[model samples]
Target: MSQVSLVAARIAALQQAGSALALLQATQELASCADASAAPVLVEVLGFNNPGAAVAAVKGLISLGPAAVEALLQLDPVNYGARAWAVRALAGIGDVRGLELLLDALGSDVAASVRRAAAKGLGQLQLDELPPDQKQDVQGQCLGALLAATSDGEWVVRYAVAVGLELLAAGLPAGSPERQQAQQGLLTLQEAADGTPPVVQRRAKLALSRLELQ
Candidate 1:
């Protein structure tokens, strides 16, 4: 079958899946195909109450690459609730428009998940994709926002910040102040053994160990 027809069939199947788990599974299948045609349906899926299904849709959009980003940009979330989910999907699929949304979301009093996703996106950005003149400034802002968020009220947000800081530190010059600070911050998270979940603490420790060797 043609790729277009296959995506259509997949979208139809996802729409027909009444069960949340079934929808989630179908969504992931569409995502694995990485077809741009699936982006619109996935965007609509963000409104679903099922977190797992919404996550699968977000992953689908991310897999769609630039096509998903463009489609997401055109969607105006008149409903405030949908806006956070849109920002999250944007966070996973970085484009200038998506980056703009993430930067704003990072500083806003939005959902912890939104803020966490923004932090991760900022760290994963390809600096070279940005204009040369804006690259340094944006990088600094990404790291600054991430470092300041190390003590976020939510452990998950703090864990995401730790991951961002670790990734940022990995690419920095030897003995750079930012690298030192990022490493210190990750260590702090790791040392907060009791306060943090084992999973988050383990992530922090892993990041710190890698950064320590860099």
Candidate 2:
């Protein structure tokens, strides 16, 4: 069979999956196929209650890269599950097209894991292809979001904030204000003792050290 036919067959299997295990298997196969045409089906699987299937779908969407961004953006806003999974896929893809969604998720998503992924995604965005002014503006936005997210109640999210700060700073000039602000944010996280988790503090300290070395 042709590759297109194989992908279609996988999509059909995913659509017709009658059991949890079957859905998982079909989603896995489709995701592994990494066909751009499978992006919609993979995204649809994110709305399902099955986590295993959703994980596979996220992988598939990430594999599709920027081609999957529009479909992910169009996911039903009411379906928080799908949105959360979409955030993860966008984070993994690190496409600049996902910038707004990642910022919103980091600042307001109720799910800590989603916020964590968004924080990381904001830092990892591919900005090299953009014009210098646009790149700086986007980096500034990401920096502000990561700084705000440092105070997040979840330790995991805070840890991700540290990560985001480091990544964003790394792309800026050594003495640039944005880079300095990012370093300051990391320092604040590192010194936070007011209920901050030790792990988060350690991660922040490590991020600060790495930034200094750069």
Candidate 3:
């Protein structure tokens, strides 16, 4: 069998293990594998009460990338807190399927941590790695979302937005409109710096300093 098949087999056994610790170990091992087949299993584990296993499972799903994104969308966690974790996981993957969810979470009544994760997740997308045709559309969507997020109620969410803008801008050239828009967003943050929390001010300032040099 191929490498992914072997990993699939190992993960199957680990999934059926009698203990959370054993499942945790399996998740750690899965994180190192590039198999997309493991995504659904990892998605289920995100709700596991064992923090370590849940975290490891999330990381593993992220490593699985777009394939894992498919599995994440099909999830409907009965536990409200599990839904938060699912949102956070979707954000981390930064897949297009998760984009709308992140955008909504940014403006929702959900936990601040979930909103913050959404901002960070958009920043983590590998847009530059996509094909030329797809990259443009994705960039536009991500930029619009990030720009809108600058007005979020929580300073933490705004801080993540600023950081995410910096990351998105980093992959573009100075003359590019997207890059310019990101810089403009940072300027908005700067103008409102005094009203924002200290942590957000620091992040906006740092992002501005970096953009100034870009």
lDDT of 1 by residue, 1-214 (tens): 8998898888889889989889899888877778787888888777776789877888778767678887676666565555677777776666655767777777774589788888787777666677765876676777778877877788888888878877777766668686777777788788755668777788989997777676
Instruction: By TM-score, rank the candidates, best first.
Output: 2, 3, 1
Query: Candidate 1 versus the native: TM-score?
Result: 0.76
Q: What is the lDDT of residue 16 in candidate 3?
A: 85
User: How many pairs of residues collide in model 3?
Assistant: 0
Tens digits of lDDT, candidate 3, 1-214: 8887888886787778789889888888877777887777787777777788888887787767788887888877466565677777877777767877676766673688888887877776766567887887877777888898898888888888988888888877788888889888888886755567777767878998987786
lDDT of 2 by residue, 1-214 (tens): 9999999999898889999999999999998987888888889999998999998889888888998888898889899989999999999899998998999999999999999999999999989999999999999999999999989999899999998888889999999988889999988889867989889889989988888898
TM-score of each: 0.76, 0.97, 0.80
Model 3 regions more than 4 Å off: 1-9, 77-80, 129-134, 192-195
Model 1 worst lDDT window (10 residues): 74-83
Q: Which residue pairs come into collision in candidate 3? A: none
> How many steric clashes does model 2 contain?
0
Best lDDT among the predictions, by candidate number:
2
RMSD of 2: 0.9
Show where candidate 1 strays beyond 4 Å. Answer: 12-29, 78-81, 94-97, 187-206
TM-score attained by model 2: 0.97
